[model samples]
Structure formats: structure tokens, C-alpha cells
Target chain A: MFNPTWAMTIEMVIAGVSVIGLFAALGLVLVLMERRVAAWMQIRLGPNRVGPKGMLQSLADTVKLLVKEGMTPDGSDKFLFNLAPYIAMMVAMLLMAPIAFAKDFRLWDMNIGVLYITAISSIMVISILMAGWASNNKYSLMGAMRSGAQIVSYELSAGLSILTIVVLTGSLNITDIINAQADGWWIFKGHIPVLISFVIFIIAVTAETNRAPFDLAEAESELTAGFHTEYSGMKFALFFLAEYINVFIVCAIGATLFLGGWMPFHIGNWEAFNHVMDYIPSSIWFFGKTFFLIFVIMWFRWTFPRLRIDQLLNLEWKYLLPISMFNLLLVTAIAILKWHF
Target chain B: MSGSTIIFYLLAAITLVSAVLAVTTRMIFRAAIYLLFSLIGIAGIYFWLNYEFIAAVQIVVYVGGIVVLIIFSIFLTQQAGEQLPKQKMGRQLFSALAAFCGLALVMLQLAQHEFTGTGNKAVEPTVANIGYQMLGVDDNGYALPFEVVSILLLAALIGCIVIALKSKPEKA
Candidate 1:
């Protein structure tokens, strides 16, 4: 029999390698999905020349980026400039640990899973700040500053919205949260409050990840690629990859929290319907829910105009923050009263 | 040594080295970054002890909130690329003396104290236990101190708003 320590070490190695592979695959697929969605919205064919239906377009881009020289500016802080992208990539990858792709399949099922995610994700802003500051460029500094403020502000609402679900479930463990949805998803069962927090959560996370409408940090016309103005080649690609991965992570968390995670849709006393839903694999359910949310986020990107810096702050502090705070209270009262199904 | 013992030593080394670097680094921005690593190392130590809740809180409050704020202030107030001005000889000597004294005091205290490990009987540092302890009305509960801390935070928030609020410009 294999020693427990050796078995654990092997398991960890496998998990680490698979996560890196998943990052690569996710980066490719998400980039393709974003391009296609954008193209469809914009009345154009996107990257059709790369491969069949342009499925390998991101792969081509990756290859191109890999070969391109990663130039560090003469005046830039060489040490930190190189370190910044890796930090961004590390934060993105570390977020994968607590997420459950399927029932009985996860990395580290620590007790404080949700809290762990929020804590680690808060570190994302530091990477941006480092990149901006290290680049020694005016635009980069401005972009980094804007991102720092934006992320710090939006984090409040995002956290409060997440706490709404945590309040309902009375647990922080991802598995426990999922298992609590066995009867029905919180969005349906918890009713108005859950729906409100879900909306707020989506908006908050969109801003948190520095996505469209809140993509002021990298506003192409305004800041010339923002904090990453100095980065090139694979270094630049790492940031791009990190962005996509962050989007996926946040969407997965959203799916797990607001949607039923891997749980299938079922109504009380609908045994046949429930069994049919159960026949669908849990991983498929998780991915479907996550992708649907991702599509919605991408849709938001295509539809809405980017908010100005002040307007973005206003939307968070004056609107989302207050509303989410109130919603948290409502959810708490509901949870206390056992009003949720 | 066991794997956990090796891990503990590694974390301690990281924490101590990064903390020293944070203070000694001439570049203000590098100091902040080093401080961040030191805080993260401390969080890792907490995780190593299986106090995951405390570790998360450490990362969230220190690395995320405080370090970011420090970096922000540095960005605003200082040229990050510029080296910080060197301290005067007297000031440097005094600071070193102070730090040495503090370290010696701590070491002396550690040598004087007799510590008994709780071993396997120690309470699990789970979130639920932390929550209960924070709010519980029992003798060991921290409900009073928790409320006091919240009140203190509220006071600080109000004070900040008060200080930052702009006065109306007088018409010339």
C-alpha cells in the first residue's frame, strides 16, 4: 500500500498540473467565446481565417505571443516589471482551489472556502498596482490608480452581496452551500432578496474584474492599454490570460452561490422531473450555469457603454453598495424567520 | 523533521526576512511590497497552524486592505522610482536602538514564560467556533470587545468624513 504522505504529494502534483492545463484551455476557449460574441454583436465575422470556424484563433494568438520578444523598457523597474504579470497570473490560479467543478471533485475543500476566495481575490489589485508603478509611465500610473480605487470601492458591494448568500446558507464552505440547495436553488427559494443580491453580485463582480462599462483602467482611447502599456509578448499574454481566468472564476463563484452550483433544478413533489434533471451530469450543470452567467456578462460588455470614472464610483458607492447592504439585512431577516424554501 | 515542521520553518524564514527587508529597503515602494510579502508570510504561518479563518482575515485585512492603502498613499505622495531620503545618523542609531530593545524585551519575556502546549486537545479554529466565540455571552466570549471595536471603527469613519468634507468657498 502507498504511504498516505506520498499519495497526498502525488495528488497535489496532479492537481497542480491539471489546474495549469485548465488555465491554458480556459484562456483559449474564453478568448474565442468573447471574440465570437463580440463579432456577433458587431455584425462581423471574427477570426474565421485561423481554423475551422476560428476555433483555433486564440491558439494562433498564443503561439504568436509566445514567439514575440517581451521587451522591458530601459527606465522601467526591471525586477518588479517582470514580477507583476506573474503575480496577476498567480492570484488567478490560486482562486481555483476552493471552486467545485462537480460533486465530490474539488481541490481544497477548506471550511472557509467563500471567505478564502474573497480574501485572495482582494490581492488582485496589488498586481495591477505593481504593474502600473513599475512601468514608470504616466498613463500606467493613472490606470493603476483608477483600478485601485475602482476595485477597492466595488469590493464592498461584492462582499456584501456574497454575504447575502452566506447569510441564507449560514455556512461559508462551498460544498455546504451547494448541498443546502438540494431542495431548490436559493435564487428561487429565497425569492426577492436573493434575486436582488444576485443582480448586485453580478454588477459588483463585473466592476471588480475590471470588465466593460468598468474597464476604465484599460480604456484604450484614454489610457493606451492602461497598466499593461509597457508589457509585451508572453508577459502581456499572461495578463490577458489572467483576465479571462478571473472572469471564469468569478462566474463560477456566482453560479455556485446564486445558481444551484452542480445541483439540478427540481420542484417539490415533482419526482419524475427531478430524476430527469438528475440524469444530467453535475459537471455539465455547473458549467452550463457558469457559461450562462459568462454569456450574460459578455452581453453586458457588448450592450452597455463604459462608465466614466466618477459615474462608476457613483454607481457603486451611491447605488449598489447601499442597495446590497439593505438586501443583506433583508436576507438576514428572511433567514432568521425561515421564510426561504 | 516532519513535513509540517519544515513548512513552518520555511514560513517563519519568509516572514522574518521579508519583514526585515520591508524596513531596510531604501525604495519606498519596494518597502511596501516587501511588507505585503511579510504579511502574506504571516498569513501562511496562520494557515500552517490550521487557523484558516484567521489566516484569511489576515490576508484580507492586512495584505488586501492596509498594504493597498499604503501603496496608494505612496503612489500619490512619492515618486515610486525615486529612492527615499537617507535618515540622519542620530535618528538611524536611535531607531536601531529602539528596535533592538523591543526585540530583546520580547526574547526575555519568551525565556521567562513557561508554555504548555494544548497538543491535540486544542480547539479547532473553524469559522463557526470563531463566530460563536465572538458573539457568545459566556465568560470567554468577546461580544463586548467586538462591539467596542465596531464602535471604534464607526467613530473613525465619521471622523474621516468630517475631516474630508469640504467647506463652502466664500464669495469674493
Candidate 2:
């Protein structure tokens, strides 16, 4: 006979499907948003040709990619070459599960959601390495190495910043952290030091995700599209999708930890305003905060020139790592002293 | 066995076999790929243990970090396609014997452990509990052990730096 566990298993399947659907939908929307934003920023018409306001540009691009030949480089490790994109995209999509969009709505609200995210996202470096190694190209290999080093170095600062949040919140659970921000977000509460940590978090995540300025991994001029140089079709699209998804994810986390996830902002003793703020649906607020962070990430992506590898490493080791360590000490002092707004 | 147990056993088998292959494979790149499977299997085991957090970390760290680093180093050394040099017959036989004996000793030790009165189901430790334990307040908390792990990490950090900084002799 069918059991409750079986029912739970079916529910899990549904959730998995929904997450996949969300990734595809979000990918379409984000790709369109990137084009429109880029166009607006540059004072150009952008893509009005595909559909209304270029709404279908990403769709058209998808079709183009699907129709395009999936070419493998001669003498490449064909099996791994083929497998790399799916692995990259799979890890990215897998990470979206534990993120709390609304109160009590997550795939698995593991007590270690934050840690799970940090750990899962770390795998992208592997996919990059695989793509690089299998391609049989020197540029790809170099790009992969740069990516590995960049991610490893930045991960330290990122982990440290998160540890400070964990210390202040007294919990690593995403829901608890979000709940902790109900009164006011940690950024505003923790004040200057938190702000500094937030800055470091943003920079570290941007570099960790391999976004521009820190995007030496695929330095187009130097590495010629870098690790995914040989990837094509939906495979290439997978990497593209995964990259944007990762951007959204880390920002979502930044929002959840620092920007009061589903919790709306209200100043002290403003009972009426605080009550009104509760009327807003949690999911909307969560997405609003996350998308705002996402826009800022995209803004940086378009704005900055790619960093040199040496400069990138120097930023982490010389600046970010030390600053984060110092910031952690400061936060610990402030928390222990109960000093906040 | 339940379906979960069956799947766990299958994954465990896959992991062990792939891990052996990963070490023994002559082709270094193939070995790397096999190692990926082995790590993925370990992640599955973490999931079975209900430490989804640890499982993800296993994937992100071992599958992602260490394996990727090894692969990149392999690439950097410009020896991706070449087969790894085979071990000498004597060394291979000796290592095989050592591993067999180690496995047998571990099996014997596990067999010697006695069962408790009531076979109570194990409760997975929550992240909060683990964190508290690490910070030294809980009854089960081994603060000294926690500090040792930190010291271990520090040692590894210094070791990595030393290795990275080691200078190669000038070519004649």
C-alpha cells in the first residue's frame, strides 16, 4: 500500500519540478531584463525587433542555441565536455531550494540553510574546472585555474562575513535569520560595521560568482570566452542560466541576511506603520529585496572593466580578507556589548 | 530493507568502487572524473544521514574545491592526457596487502561493538546544537576539540603557504 512517506516523496518531486520551472522562467525574465537595462543605460533602442520591447529576445536566442550545432573540439574529452554544462546548471538550480521567499516556504528548511548554500555554491568552481580540463585548450585551463583561485580566496571572506551574521543572529537557519530581521534589518541595526561587512559580502559574492570586474575567469580578450570556450547550444545556455541564477541566489542570501527578507522596514514606536507593513505579502517583499540586489549586481556587471588576475587576488588577500577579519572582531565586540541603534 | 536503505547501499557501493577506481586509474583525467563520482556518493551518504547541510558542503568543498583544484593542477602541469606512471609490482603488492589488513581490522572492530538495550532511532544533530557545542556551552560540547579543529585548519593554511612559496632550483 502507498504510504505517507510515498506522498511526501511525491511532494518532493513536485517541488523539484517547480524549482526547475522557476529557474527557466527566471532565466527568461533576467535575460530580457539584462538586455533592456543595458540598452537603457547605453541610450540605445536595444531589441525591439524580436517582440514587443524585445520581450522575446531571450526566447529567440534560446531557439537559436537549440538549432545551433553542438560542436565538440577535436581531441577533447567528449564525455566530460558534454557533461560539464549540466553539472554547472544543476548545482545552481539545486541551490535555489533552501532560500525562503515567503515565511515557512522553502524546499527543505534545514537548520543549516546558510551553510548548505555556501557549501553547494562552492561546487560551481568544480564545473568550471571540468569544462576547462576537458576542452584540451590552454586558455581554458588557465581560465579554470584563475576561477579556482578566485573562488577559494573570496570564499574565506564570504564565509567570515556570514559567520559574523551567524554570530549576531545566533542561528544559521535562514528562517530564523529572516525572523531576526523582523524589527529592522541587521545592516541598519549593526550600523557601520555591518555596512562594511555588507560591502565586503557584495564584493566577495560578485567575485565568487565570477561577475564583471572580478570576471577574469572568462576574460574575453585574454582567454577567449575562457572555460566554456568550447560549449555550445543549450549547453552554453546552461552555463549562462547558472551564472545569472547564482547572481540572484547570493543576492537573495544577502537580502535574507541583511535586508530583512520578508520583513518590511519600520522605525521605532511606529505602531501604525509597522502594522501596515505586515499587510504586504512576504514572498513579494522577499523578491522585491532580492531583485533590487540583483539589479545592483547587474549594474556593477555592466559598469566595471574586468580585473586583472593579480589585482583580483590582491583585492581578496590584501583588502577584503583583512577588512572582513577586522570587521568580524568589531561586530563581535558590538554584539557582546549590545551596542546598536 | 526499505527503499531508502536500498538506495543508500547502492550509492555506498558506487562510491567505494569509484573511489578505488579513482586511485587506481592509470589515466589521470579519468581518475579525476571517477573521484568526482566518489565525492558525489559521499554527498549522497550525507543526505542519507539527514545532514543535508553537510552533504551540500561535501559537494561544494570536496567535489567542488579539492577535486577542481587537483584537476586544475593537472592541467597546469601540462599532463592531462598522459597515463600516470604505473607503480612497481613490489610496492603495489605491499600496498594491496596493507589495505586488505586494514579493512579486516576495521571489520573486526565494528563486529566487537555491542548493541544497547533499546534500539532507539538516532536523532540527527541540529545546526544550532552543533554550533552551540562548538562554542563550548553544551554538555556534549568538546570545546577543546573545537579549538583543535581550528588549530588544524591553521596548520593546513601554513602548510599550503609553505608549499606554494617553495622555490624551484634554477635550471642548468
Candidate 3:
């Protein structure tokens, strides 16, 4: 039959289907949620006609995308133009493997799960570059270059912030990181330094994901649609999906690292509080923490103005990186001294 | 072929083909993409060998960091869309012959050695283990190498800052 490990193979197939379903559902709900949030911010009613409270708006959008013609710009590199969207989609899917949704539930709980995530997410930058370069347009190329510079700078602070949490937990395994916070989440447990790291992590990951005010890669006002200016229909949809999935991944990891991923709020030796928190399913708590973080990100998008390219780099290189590096040391001290409360 | 052997060969095929494509491609952009493929294929082999940490680092540093940097530079230089000039036929033939000789020599060297599988005792190296080794709390620790790398990185960063901040003189 030319097969190897039929049982594991079958399990992977099942997990693949579930992952696809989760990705689609999350995309639909987040898009709908973003619209409502945007409307609330702008004092307008958003997409309430299609379904109850515009729940089916994303579905309608999906159908429209499906029906639209997929096109390539006339002077574009045809092969890479076609390939760029898949590159983005595949990177997102690859990143999905390391996330742990519930107790003993994950695609691949590798020993270096967190590092794998940091590594795989970097591919998203390449996909953007490919799309921009292949579009054969000046604005697209400019957008892509801005993104390449932005992501490279921001990743240092992001990685350092994550390593801060890793120092506190003594492991890069996501589950191990989570379980270490059973007494209390890092934000609540590791005193002031962890709090600082958490803040830096949030800001760095916000920039890393290219959401506004850092969303200059596709900055609509200046570079109309940016790297994705030339992409239309399904290819654009893939890029959109990848972006949302990336948000979910980074937030989920943040929750896992700092918010006691799938961990309910438990105070030290507070028996009743611990019991109440434990009653909720781990998956629910997981998603709850993740969504709360996502909401925070969306709130950031609506509240802040887009940063200038220089301001963004200056924020990272000067402010975030130094602060994160200092926070890492403070955390390492807290970790060594056993000073965490 | 057995399953593991088949996988090994498949990964080898991907790595070799992509490396060749990376070298031979006319378009610089496609060459970079092919180099990405080759790096990822080698990472796949590391994953196959169960060196998960090394595999992750390989992807993070090479495919993700260096290749992206290369592509970014190409974009900056406005050379992403251009085709590289072809080498003369005589030079191409000479390089091809040299490449074959090198490959055959490496193959001969490899064939002289014996490789044993330790599948039954496969080591699942953890991040914690790496951390301990990096900190050098135990025997066979890498603390010196780690500190050296840190110093090297520090020196590089300082060099970068100095170079970037240096101003050019105005032409008279």
C-alpha cells in the first residue's frame, strides 16, 4: 500500500479537516466582529441586513469572492504571481500545527513549539514580498519593502519578549509554559517585570502582525491596498485569511505565554476560586483568553492612527527592543531569585 | 525502498534540485525562491532525523531571516525583476566538470564511512536541555561558545551602528 503508520496517518487526516473548519469559522466570525467594532467606533450601523446582526455578512463576502474573476496584472511575473497567495496560506497552515487548543489536544506538540511558531511566522513576510514584487507595480513594491523592514525590526523585540516568558517558565513547550502558570498567570504572577514583558509582547506582536497602526504594508491611504494592491478575488481572500489567522496565532501564543493559556484564574490557595475557574472546559478558557487578546488588538486598530515608517522603526529599535531586553533580564533575575509571587 | 529510505531520498531530491535551480536560475528572484526551497528541504531532513530544535532554528535563521533579508536587498536594489547574464559555454562546461568532480569526491568520501541508525534510542532534545547546555551548568556545556557568540553579536551590532552613522564628505 506504500503507507507508513496508518493509524497516525488517519489521525492527521482527521485533524486536518478540523483545522480547516476552525480556520474558516474563525475567519468568518473575526471579519464580522471587526465590521461591528469598526461601525461602533465610527458611529454607524454595520452590515446588519444579511443575517441577524450581520452574522452572515462574511459568508456573503465569501460567495462574492468565489464568484469574482481571479486576475493577474499585465506585466506581472505569471508563475510567482499565482504562487504568492498559496505561500501565504501554507505558512499560516504550517503555523497552526504548534498551537494547543485544549488539554492534550494539538496537531503537533513539539518540544520547541514556541520557537517553531516564531520561525514559521517569518515566512509571511516572504509571501508579502512575493506578492508585491510579482504585482509589477511601484506602490506594491514600496509597500512590500516597508513591510520587510518593519517585520525584521519588530521581530527582535517580539522574540525577546517571548524569551522573557520562556525564562519565567523554563521551557519553550507551549503546554509546559501554560502549566507553569497554573498557580496564576504570568501577568499576575511574575510581578512587575513579567507585566512589562507582557506589555512589550503585546505591542511587538501587534506590530509583527502588521495590524494598524502598523499596517503600513497595505496602508490604504498612501499605497492603496499596498502589497495586495494588484491582487483580486480569491488570491486576495487567501491573503486576508492569512492575516486573520496570523492574528489568531500570535494572540493565542500570547494568551498561552502570559495569560495562562486555557488556564482559569486561580489565586494562591484560594480553594473556592480555583474550583469555580476549573469548571469551564479548557478549550473554552483557551478561546476565551485568545479572543480577549484579539479584541484588544482590534481595539488598537480602531483607536490608534497609522504610524509613519520612521516612527514605527524608531518605536521598535529604540523603545520596544531596549525595554524588552531589560525586561528579559529582570525576568531572569526574578526566575533565579524565586521572587515571583 | 523502505519508508525511511524513501523519505530520505525524497528530501535529498528536493534539496539537490532546488540547490541546482537556485544556482542556475536566470531571474534573481526565482533563484532566491529556489534557495528558500533548498533550505526548507534541508530543514525537512532535520525534522526527519528528529532534530526538532535544529530544524526549527534552520527554518528561522536561514529560510525566514537570511532569505528574507536577501529578498529585501534585492527589492531595494531594484533587481528583483531582472535576469542574470548567462555564462559563456566554455566556462559553463568547466564549472560543470568541476562540480561533478567535487560531487564524486564527496560521494567517495561518504561511501568510505559507516553510518549506524540509533532509532531505538532516538534523543528528543528539549529546549530546557539546550538552555542548560547554553548556560554551561553541566559537563559538555556550551557556555564559552555561547558567550563568544554573544560578544560576537554585540561587536557586530556596534560595528553596524558606527557604519550606519558615519557621514560621507560633500564633494567640492
lDDT of each: 0.93, 0.85, 0.88
Q: Native contacts recovered, in order, as a fraction for each?
A: 0.61, 0.57, 0.61
> Can you list each candidate's DockQ?
0.68, 0.52, 0.60
Question: Which prediction has the highest TM-score against the true structure?
Answer: 1
Could you give the candidate ranking by lDDT, starting with the highest?
Answer: 1, 3, 2
Worst 10 residues of 1 chain A by lDDT: A1-10
- Report the error of model 1 at residue A336, Å: 1.0
Candidate 2 Cα errors over 4 Å, as ranges: B52-61, B85-91, B117-124, B135-141, B148-172
Candidate 1 lands at a TM-score of: 0.97
Candidate 1 Cα errors over 4 Å, as ranges: A1-5, B118-120, B169-172
In angstroms, how far off is A210's CA in candidate 2? 1.2
lDDT of 2 by residue, A15-88 (tens): 98998888988888888888887887788877898888678998999889889888888978887788889888
Error of 3 at B86 (Å): 1.6
lDDT of 1 by residue, A220-273 (tens): 989999999999999999999999999999999999998989999878668989
Q: lDDT of model 2 at residue A300?
A: 87
Model 2 chain A poorest 10 in a row by lDDT: A1-10
TM-score of 2: 0.92
Instruction: Give all candidate RMSDs, comma-separated.
Output: 1.5, 3.1, 2.4
TM-scores of the models, in the order given: 0.97, 0.92, 0.94
